[model samples]
Target: MAGLSRPLETELTFPVRTYDIDFAGIVSNIVYVRWLEDLRVRMLERFYPIEPLLARGEGPLLARTEIEYLRPVRFGSTVRGIMWAAGHGRAVFDLQADFEVAGETVARARQRGVFVHYGRMQVMPLPKELRSQMESAPASSRQQGG
Candidate 1:
């Protein structure tokens, strides 16, 4: 049996640029997923620098992802991106992301990833140190609707 899991939290703020808007004048659906992906990578980098992981010949790889858009964000709006690890087991970790504007959540996402030994290209357990780092971090602020 796997031990209890904790969520790792991170927050990011950025302005919606013209390039991210769609024909309807709101953020494109695809862009939301992109933002979620960026947030996940950034969160990992903040807790465990990716460069060092690469040097160690081990890195996390996205195994699957899902996104749900609750609202649209228009160009010029300031949006906040938050990410967290939802669960962790022997070989995989589930991550979640939320996008917000003015304290209102605009979107949410989930991703499952596996730690891999790069050279061998094999799935591996998340390092104990990395898991401890996640467990020790405080949870992110909850969105108005979340």
Candidate 2:
């Protein structure tokens, strides 16, 4: 399968474990969502420095998430997690992710997160610094030559 490229994205790799699989020997639905979330957070930390941004009382918080399972992921399979910002608005941004095994897509997910003030817990615009940093970061391995 061909890899899809997007701007300002990150890819993480993991091996499917026996525990991640269901009785049918395929990855459980819940595990797929968790993996997607893990990759999304990793991308945020890698490119946007979410920990520091949160420490400063500013960062994006997950507001909603949706997942679509396209194929089965079996135990012992090596999976790749690809994550990137799909869209951004004044207060909310959409993070998109895909799980693939042997270059075949198993699932896709999208998370809508909003920048919020920690103290007030109110939605806020993404900081210019964070946005700029994310925008400047490399989007996909295809472009960077993995």
Candidate 3:
């Protein structure tokens, strides 16, 4: 574990739009879901692109999602979200994210997903390429320890 590189984290930012707020002037719960979806898409786009997976007729599907609001996000606030592939099993891949406003945590979310064969509707194992990328350090970020 000491020698293994940390998992790749994908960070993104979102502004609290007027449409994202509720009558109470706080971000709606559904908006968090949308942001989570965006995080997942960006994660894929940054790492293993979705185009190839879709072309192969296999792609990840969200099996479950859980989000906890720690603080209210008001309008004019920008949320910074950082997500990473927490871990994976034979078929299930887990992702974790934290949304922070001005360096303070506003919410935390987790997503459980699985890859499936489109036509057959069968589960597929996690791709080695993805696993390796997540486990290896980024070339630019890798630094020798003293």
Q: Which candidate is the best by lDDT?
A: 3
Alpha-carbon error at 101 in model 3, in Å? 0.6
TM-score per candidate, in order? 0.82, 0.82, 0.86
Q: Deviation in angstroms for 146 in model 1?
A: 28
Per-residue CA lDDT of model 3 for 1-146, tens digit only, reads 12323465788899999999999999999999999999889889878987888999999889899999999999999999888777766667778889999889999998888888989999888777886765554444332221
Model 2 whole-model lDDT (C-alpha atoms): 0.74
lDDT of 3: 0.81
> Which candidate leads the pack in TM-score?
3
Off by over 4 Å in 2: 1-5, 133-146
Global lDDT of model 1: 0.77
Ranking by TM-score: 3, 1, 2
Candidates' C-alpha lDDT? 0.77, 0.74, 0.81
CA lDDT of 105 in candidate 3?
Answer: 96
Cα TM-score of candidate 3: 0.86
The full ranking of all candidates by lDDT, starting with the best, is 3, 1, 2
Tell me the RMSD of model 1 versus the true structure: 7.5
User: Candidate 3: worst 10 consecutive residues by lDDT?
Assistant: 137-146
